[model samples]
Target: MTKPESAEQDHGYDVVISGASLAGSAAAILLARRGVRVALLERRSDPDAYKVLCTHSITANAYPVLDELGLIPAVEKTGAPHNDARWHTRWGWIEPKAAPRGPELPHAYNIRRSTLDPMIRSLAARTPGVDLLLGHQVTGLVREAGRTVGVRASAPQGEREIRAGLVVGADGKDSAVAKYAGVPTQRHENTRFGYLAHFRNLPLDGGIGQTWFLEPDMAYAFPNDDGVTVLAVLPDKKHLPAFREDLEGSFLSFIRALPEAPPIDGAERISKIIGTVDYPLISREPTAPGVALIGDAALTSDPLWGVGCGWALQSAQWLAEAVAPAATGRGDLDRSLALYARTHRRRLRGHQFLAVDYAKARPFNPGERLMFSAAARDASMARHMHLFASRLIGPMRFLSPVALAKATAVNIRHRGTAASARPRTHSEP
Candidate 1:
């Protein structure tokens, strides 16, 4: 911890946020809307830039936040559409037939980060109190009296300091602010690597997102903007050798092998195949002194779950709500930061645990099989499962004792029915 006292403390903004992408921009928008000063720093120079290596499936849980930001209509205007999600389990596809979640709950958004990022940055940069400092790379934390006051950033002009009451790290998984703040993180080993490619003219349900959990291998297909469908696969490392041999060939082969494979025959690859193998599940305590972390900076889970974009927006909302009064000078800022930290942990701990558990790339256990089977049999179970996956409901609600018992009984009944149908040999008698 490098705590140094500065001779001339420069308090420029209420909050200096690193990374002007999803989380940082969203936080800036929130605070700026409330007339709190914000400095949004981004390393990228391009105003239209987006995160290229992402599947970009925004979960339903972030819909409310989008609405609050007044950006949902903008996203829709950009051809990004609402999505209905279905999960493929061992028994069958756990497809919920319910209408899309209301404004109070999370809902799905199928938009590329290319469109989403610029839209988000535009909103933040245009906010009255936000200063969008593009092409700025955060180098170190500005410390005063043993608390992080802001950041030392290098921009196109030169290196300079930006001071604030609080500094936020929304800088993705390998967060420089988190590193500078000496924030503690727990890394979990991930057994699977992810690959995603966009295809044009793919024949599929227009606004439906589908995921197949074939044990150690999982694949998802979502129809996104501009008549393109994104197909992604998470295969265990054991299968990487074959994929490395032929990137495009192997990706197509793997997806084609799924039980009810996507109808992508004769589809054109619109983008280069994007992939990542080093995505370890990362969970960090989201605050340090005067600094707070949001998005992947705070907690990065399995990519197979497609929760990053949603979590980024949702966490930003949580932080903004938690610290608004303090940042506006109505309450103690440190106590407000602590409040944000506690709220972040409470909201994400259970989700992170389950995501990390699945990141091990292991096949479903008996309990999981029971739940999946029950979800396949019961619409209510399927709806609950979908709500949990979308992050509209927490783990405690999704994994209650009643749900577990129902799943167990459903599985037992399925077993009994199968056993009754089996032919018996007289030799045993």
Candidate 2:
């Protein structure tokens, strides 16, 4: 470990966060708001730089965090629509109708990362007590007596040592801080690969999102800001050879072949189709002495569910909430770190487990088949599924005895009339 005093300049703060992306920026902003000085570091030179290969769906479970950060209005100003998703299942469509009156139902948001990332980064930069260090790439960590003391960042001018009471690794799944700190990570293989591209003039109803659960394969159409629709396909590895032979042709054919497929032929392609064959599920123990990890740095779930963005924001909030009092000189930092770790696991571990299992691209289990088929036949069943898929409820509650019993009864009731009750194909009105 390098001595902190050897650097040309040593900056001190309550927290030094690596990577000024969603997790880093949100952590910095929330920590700074609680009277903690923060140094937000980003390797990217451009302030407007955004992640390109992302579905960019923020789940409804994180709306409270966005509201607390005073970002909802700004988010709306970007023309991001509240996304209500409809799923295509083997039984038929599970499209729940919205309640006509009373309190509004929860919904997720669909905004391209190109518009969302810069907006949040700028917000954090403008926040008081947050020193946004652009182009400062974290290269090493400063440790003393087995505790991470700070980070060594390489900047345009020279190497600078930043000392802080707590070091945060909000960088990404491939986190330098986690790597340098020797955090243990568990990797799970994803049997399905993904490909996506943006299009214009897509006539999906009310810009709502659509997902097709084709057993081992999946596809999605997310209508986003500025009249853009992102069409994506996640196919099992068995199709890899065909996709590798002709990327665009394979992607287009896959989407066009979906039951009640979207109007791909009618829409104009706006961006190059991006494909990624490998993105293993990653889960890391999120805390060490004087250190805490957030966002993809801590856990990278299957992209098939589009949980990364919301989890990034939610994890940042959890960390800041856990450590803010300690950083403000009012509590024990170690205890706070422990609390954050516990809370993180309690909230996300089950979800991550399910996501990793499904990432293998296996056929749905018996429970899934029962629940999905029942959902297609019953409105209440569909609503329950909507809540679960929107992430408003956890797997525990979603798979509870009550829900399963309800689903079983629904299936029994529809046994004879199920075919007649099935939703019309997407080609219908």
Candidate 3:
């Protein structure tokens, strides 16, 4: 690792990034690779600290970035499962089967945050030109002439002021940098509360991930590293009291009641049930002049889709790609910032819209019902659903005119068959 240049003495770094977790660290590494200096600040003193309340699923769409970062081999070595998902709907199971000679299906990874966070952080620390400053918490932003220029942080040594060409807030949803920068944000209510726990020896066929869309409620069993399975439930607020009364019991009951449920009862429970009763969906302006936000700081959509970790990686990549030329003194930083913001919004807006709408815990609308049922009955429809649900494609493509037509035709064909198969009661005696 290169010695971290004194940020204050070096006329400031190219970028000062808050939060040395997934987004922050990855941004630092990517920027440094593009010949820019970065100061990656993390509040936690412990290098091994990890986020406990995360789904920890990295969607397949993010694999390209991971491969570029030289992390896929390391991630696979951690025993994380390359997971394909199957959804249980009222109509039936919407599982996309691979064609015999077709290209390999896309798959995500299920790894615990405990292992992933520190791994990425360590990689960032070793990368040249990245100052992974642990135990440094951003207290405020440094603004000059109404533009954010850097950050004010409290370091283990003492209060430190780090100036930079750009400041990035990679901190979580409650981003102090965003707050201090006065970044415009939107918040939406999530009517569903969540609970999850880890278990050992859970019998899931082929270790494939399973999800149940029980109308207003949802449940999942995701096989993770080290032979552990994560069982999670997201129930509407109407069921909060029961969950609050018997958190473990209610969680288990809700999961066990699902069709083709995992053998949780027979499995050995490894972690206590963790519950999050209220989590607001948040979206912030991705960039402001010299300041940029990534990961949860930029957008905290519903976790039901398990897009957080993947988005964190991809957004960091996008920010680094957008600003690297500017940071390296080849372009205008403001234009770069605008590019980053535009790219971020373009890639995530549709996904966020759909996620926020469903976060209300509303029952399936006609469109949702039509699509989900069609997905269960038709392989091509199921493949499209799988791609969208995996965050591999945008909503526009998933709900394209062609997709809608195919779904309508499949449903109508099924409807006709059902009517023809119906038995008639004796009439006109």
Candidate 4:
């Protein structure tokens, strides 16, 4: 990548991005590739700084974007597990026995955040026109006429003001940039606490992602890189004591209690049991004036689905594609922001709605039970369920009128079979 000449301290670049996570870095690379000078800021000074010990699964739905970014080869080169998913539904394990139908049915990547974050950040830094500003912490928004115009950041050498046509909050759920800009957001409480640790050598679940939807308690085993698997258990608030009293014991017991528990009973632990209890479901307006938000800064619901990584990259792609013309001075910035927001809502709202509803720790509703059971019993139904989980389709589309009709028929047939299977009872006189 060629070195970029520094622009004036005032209005320095085409875009000023707040965080250097997936969304931020992705936006930087995409924009800079189109001759948009970008200032990508990271609070941590180290170029290798990565999101630690958190979710790092990116579904196959985002593979096209990854390929577009020229990241697929590098990511594959890392030897990250190419994992298939199996969902434990009420009826049974809903596993797709058929091979992937096409190139679209790609295997998802399960790499550690420690590796992924740095890799992506490095990719952005190496882009031609991106000024990767490490250790720059955004202190306040620079607003003009009630519109975000720039950001005031604090760095090792004191403070500096950088301006741009757009400022993006790619920061995490508790977004400092969004907060400083006073972006209005709808917040939902998470009724469950999550705990996890990395284990090595679980032969039964080798290179396969297994998620159990046990109502009120959920478990995930993500086969990750370097022969490691990250095991997570999310339990309702009422079940917090089991984790508090004995972390390992409770985690193991919960896994053992799972109907389709893997032979991870004696897997070797490779990391400490870390957890998060106060993770919230947040949804904010995606744009504010000259500022736009992406990834968790815009929306973060239940982590149980592992959609965060995909959304981060996806929303960045949406924003960059929508705003590229604006960055190049060909389109209206506000209109572009509006388009991005509309696209974001249209693409994500259905999934967010269902995720928020499930985050409340409630039992599965009739529709959910119907879908899960049908998906378990029928291969055709399982394919749709698999697609939905892979982020290839949204909830509303997955549960169409035809789907409901099929689910009803499946349930009726199962009921009939059960009734027939019941033995005849003879009453003695």
- In TM-score terms, which candidate is top? 3
lDDT (CA) per prediction: 0.83, 0.87, 0.88, 0.84
Model 4, residue 23: what's the lDDT? Answer: 90
- Per-residue lDDT value at 229 in model 3: 90
**TM-score of every candidate:** 0.93, 0.94, 0.96, 0.94
Candidate 2 achieves a global lDDT of 0.87
**Per-residue lDDT over 317-412 for candidate 3, one digit per residue giving the tens place of the 0 to 100 score:** 999999999987899999999999999999999999999999989888888988999999988888889788778889898889999999999988
Which stretch of 10 consecutive residues in model 4 shows the poorest summed lDDT? 1-10
Following a full C-alpha superposition, what root-mean-square deviation does model 4 have from the true structure?
Answer: 3.6
Ordered by TM-score, highest first, the candidates read: 3, 2, 4, 1
Write model 4 residue lDDT over 1-429, tens digit each, in one string. Answer: 312223225535889998998899998998888788899988888777887646669986777778778988888888897658888866788886564564444566988888888888999988988888888889998888988888998887778899888999999898998999889889998999999888887765435788888887898998888778888999998988767998889888888888868777678888888988778899999998898999999999788888898899999999999998897798999999999999999999989998999999988987888898888887778878888888888877799999888877887777777668886363111
Off by over 4 Å in 4: 1-11, 99-104, 423-429
lDDT winner = 3
What TM-score, to 2 decimals, does candidate 4 have? 0.94
lDDT (tens digit, per residue) of candidate 2 on 60-161: 888988887889998899888887888998888988765556346687689999998998899898888888888788999999999998998897778888
Q: Give me the overall lDDT of model 3.
A: 0.88
Better structure of 1 and 2 per lDDT: 2
**Model 3 spans > 4 angstroms off:** 1-11, 423-429
Q: Which stretches of candidate 1 lie over 4 Å from their true place?
A: 1-11, 99-106, 205-207, 415-429
